[model samples]
Target: MRWFWIFAVGHLLLWTAVPFFTQANGPLDNVEMLNWGHEWQWGYPKHPPLPAWAAEAATYLPGGPVWSTYLLSQVCIVGCFWAAWRLGRETLSPSLALAAVAVLEGSIYYNCTTPEFNNNIMAKACWAMFILFAYYGIARGRMVDWGAAGIFLAAAILSKYDAALLLAATLLFSSLHPRARVCWRTPGPYVLTGVSLLLTAPHLWWLVNNNFATLRYIAARSSTSPSWLSHFEHPAEFLGAQLGAVAVTLILATILLGWRWRFKTVDSSAQFTRTYLAWMVLGPLGLALAYSLITGAHLRSMWGASMFTFLGVLLFAWLEARPDPALIRRTIYASAIVGGIFAAGLGLRNMIGDSLVTAPLRVDYPGQQLASQVEEIWSQHSNKPLENLGGDWWLAANINVYHPDRPSISAEQDHDLPAWTALDAWRTEGGIIVWETATAGDNYETQIKALYPNVEILRPLEFAWTKNQQRPPLRVGMAVVPPLAPIRTAELPTPAQH
Candidate 1:
């Protein structure tokens, strides 16, 4: 009881310290995360509903910012660590259990920036719950344990398709283990399967409504590897990252496994062996390697496996082979500090925006800034329809999303939506076309200069970095175009005329 209290207190304290930590006053992430609060469906276009669902919960917290969702994610991760400790203790010594908790929760990688608060979080939570429950039912012979296992397995799969890979590994390891045949005959495993299907029904409905987009996305990612390195780099990088995240414990486990198998005679310890092989040692790393070889696709790292920390318990247990109280105490402090560092890193990412994931942090919309400058120029020059050039769908969408007033030519496609820009056909007069990478807010100077090569550049779009704390580097600019020739009405009909 005292040890459990200590672990719980440690977990709570670590989470409490960094919830408010942010790099800047404002969060700099794209609207994708914020957009999550608006609705809930079985699945989102990009990720499963878990991250967004958690985001919804955070929104209800006191003065909770969008970044709060990331913190909530840690709550789920720490719970998994608790479950792992219990499993370790049941099979090994109490000291190894403590060590297992430390290894699992010590790192910043899993709790900090990873398992982004989306489907990935859902996957982790569900998978961990499944592991915890599976262990419970199998060890204790309870029907409730069976039910929980099924529910979690279903939930994990709903969050990310890759969880199915873990499922396969779990069954394979269970069957290969010494008691594998009897483990399946029990009611516990069956209950878990039934519960999983019940939870999975909603996802099935979503897949139907979304017109099989999820299926396509799943199919695309399921490939193991490709001929070119570029195609394979993503999965390979993901593989290396997972190893690094839990490298300390994994190494210890490998070294200790031989000893445990040889010397340990306890039958209950066999469950721990199964868990080590099924979840930590074999499940994730094995699945990633499989995807690389068979799927021929760039395998992602966090595909339903962020609970690698549990494998760390085996290391702590091995270290416990010495039974030195002083060593254990020191390891505890080190793990706490290490875990705190990782937790803080995650908090920082949420507070400042995930700059590590995104580059430059600035987004472009069809000449959004330039459009405002152009409108000002047109007002000065009599609002006469002007011929424009270099406008694309990317620019068009930005004009619509940001500058609703900046009219431009855009067709219906990826960048073009039902905006006023495309219908405002008055911008077809082709004398001095305005196109610039950057320029000052003005009229026709850019167009006039571009038309006349000898013209001195006066007002170019000025770019400045926005001083947002939560965001990486960001800059915005505006430019002007000058009318070179007299307005040609025969060719430049009024917008109404067009």
Candidate 2:
């Protein structure tokens, strides 16, 4: 238990501190989320509202610290670690329970990719809680436990609609377990279902009323060719990615607990716990594969966030039949080695990435400078504060996050925007527009002019960003269209209303 807390706290600080200093302006999703969070809604075009709500809530601290969001991401990550610890402790020995969590730090999903406080990270925490509560509910037949499971399941779905894939897996497990099957007749399961539906009712209504915009966005993002070859190609690609993601953790676990597979005496209690872990982990992967095969959907690597939550427990349970302090110590050593390598690798990448003159990541974006210049230009033209921000998600998100007023975003080029504010309202209260320079033969400026024909196009501003002293500077081109008319409404959405 002492070691578990040490690993958990270390994981939290390492993840939080690295991104806080190394990332210049934070990742694109983090900025985009803060932009969405400026206004609260039941749903956004690409995902549900929970992630945005979480991001918005974090800004309530005195300074609205950028590191707070990163901290929030780590908080979610630590919650996942704790949930896995709790679940394993109940089913397995305490040492093995700690091992279950220790092994996961090496996984890229749990540590490397967690710095970005995106929907994927948020979903992981909710998914872990849902699985833990579901296990307790089914194992103990407790109504309170089942209710908590339902609530977290709803949170998972609200984090990303794809979480329904995991929920389907849970339903499959309920049917297969003899004891859990009896839950079908009890009010607990029914009430659990009701609780999930009740919590998600608003988002579901938004989906229907908006013509399932999120589904459409996902289809566009994941669309592939209709050829028969793609069915095989897509699923194979997905499987390969999944395997690669867990490769390090799998290798380390194999070293700690060799190729032997053992089962506890066919005790119903032991079997139930093992089955729950196996089914939840395997069921989702199966559904992902099925979806890939049937729809030829391009499965992104991030979707693997919840797939390996119970993998460590499964590995430790099969390898260690009896409590062995020596084996547990060895597992801890191996975990530190693997986790250290992962952390060191991440730090090296961030350090090297800052010096790369070519192919810079979003973390290198000079959002603060751009926001300052744009706002300065806007003040010259209008007495009112910047109320509306328009452009692409990346550029607009950059300005919105740092701009003084935290303007309402208007990514008009991107369709399926939720009615965070009325279009008429935007027209009445004109806003600043910003976009990158056009490449050769590109007419992004012409398109922006066409959209807002009444406004004048300001001279393009060429800003150079070089965070690391060793790197050659990056040149970014930006143009701003200052507000034409000013209208301030008492009804403008603010973080406080959320």
Candidate 3:
């Protein structure tokens, strides 16, 4: 238990502190999430609302520090680790349980990618917690456990739709096992299904009303049409990536087991635990592989985040014939090495990133300064605060997070004006239309000009990358659509005055 907490707390603190110190602001996804979180709905175009809600809650924590999102990501990661430890203790020794969690640190998903506080990170805790609850419910046939499982299952799905794969796998496992099959007659299974659907009903309705925007976004990520060569190419690449991602854990396990371990089918009572572990570990990964093969879809590396929550426990039970103290000592050393290597790599990346001439990282962008300049430029023409922003999601998110008003970012690609704001209100409120003049923003200056033909196009401003001044300056072009009515001084307090 002491070891478990040590790893969990250490993991949380290490990840949170690294990003807080190293990153100028948050990452692109982090700022985007904060933008969505500020005006949360049932769903977004790309993902569900849970991640946004979590990020929003972090920002609302008294002082609204940017580091809070990093902390939120760490909290989710440690929660997953704790869940793994709890499940491990049911079938393995305390030492083995600690190793189960320690393995997670090796994965970039739980370390390097975690501080972004995106949907993948948010879903991880829900995935682990749901698995733990579902295992207890099926094993013990307890109503309370089933209920908890249902709620968390909803949370997992709400965090990201990939959780459906796990749910399907669990159902398939229960159907095949004799003892688990008995759950069909119980109220617990029914309750679990009913609760999940009930919790998901609102998001489902939102999807229907909004024309399944999130699904379209998911489709955009993958190859919808099959290609003859991609069937072989995509899956092979995905498999290779998965192996590389999990190599550290596998290597450590291999070192400890050394081909000496064998699976023991002797214990009947343990069969269910082993089977459950196998299905949970294999299910999501198998689905991803199959999808890649069938559709030639590109499976993202981060999608593997929730798939390996129970991997360490499964490996320990299947292998690790007996505990070797020397092997255990070596495992700790290996884990430490993983942590050190990741820290050094991330530090080096941040440090050297600005010096390169190819392109500056989003972190290198002087978003706050740009926002201030844009706000000043807008205020000179219009009495009202910048009420809305128009551009690509990344640039809009940058302004959304830093601008004094924290205006809503309406992407040009958003088809439904009602989903963001009424077209009339947006036109009446009349805000800044911006596009990146260099590097990014999709070269949308022509589109913005065409959209607001009557609006005055301001002079293009060049902003230097704060961290990398040697790099060419980023040019930003803006246009202001005059507000319908100037805000009276007594009517509402300005953002600066507030």
Each model's C-alpha lDDT?
0.52, 0.77, 0.77
Considering every candidate listed, which one attains the maximal TM-score? 3
Tens digits of lDDT, candidate 3, 99-208: 76677668777777777789998888999999999999999999999999999999999999999888888888889989889999999999999999999999999999
Counting clashing residue pairs in each candidate, in order, gives 32, 0, 0
- Model 2 agreement with the true structure over 252-299: per-residue lDDT tens digits: 676556667555554677777877888888899999889889987788
Alpha carbon lDDT at 475, candidate 3:
76
Model 1, residue 440: displacement in angstroms?
15
RMSD of each: 10.1, 4.8, 5.2
Better of 1 and 3 by lDDT: 3
Give the winner by lDDT: 3
Question: Candidate 3 — what's its lDDT?
Answer: 0.77
Off by over 4 Å in 2: 63-65, 260-266, 321-323, 419-421, 424-427, 440-457, 468-498
- What is the lDDT ranking, best to worst? 3, 2, 1
Model 1 residue 237 distance off true place after TM-score fit, in angstroms: 4.6
lDDT of 3 at 356: 66
TM-score of 3: 0.90
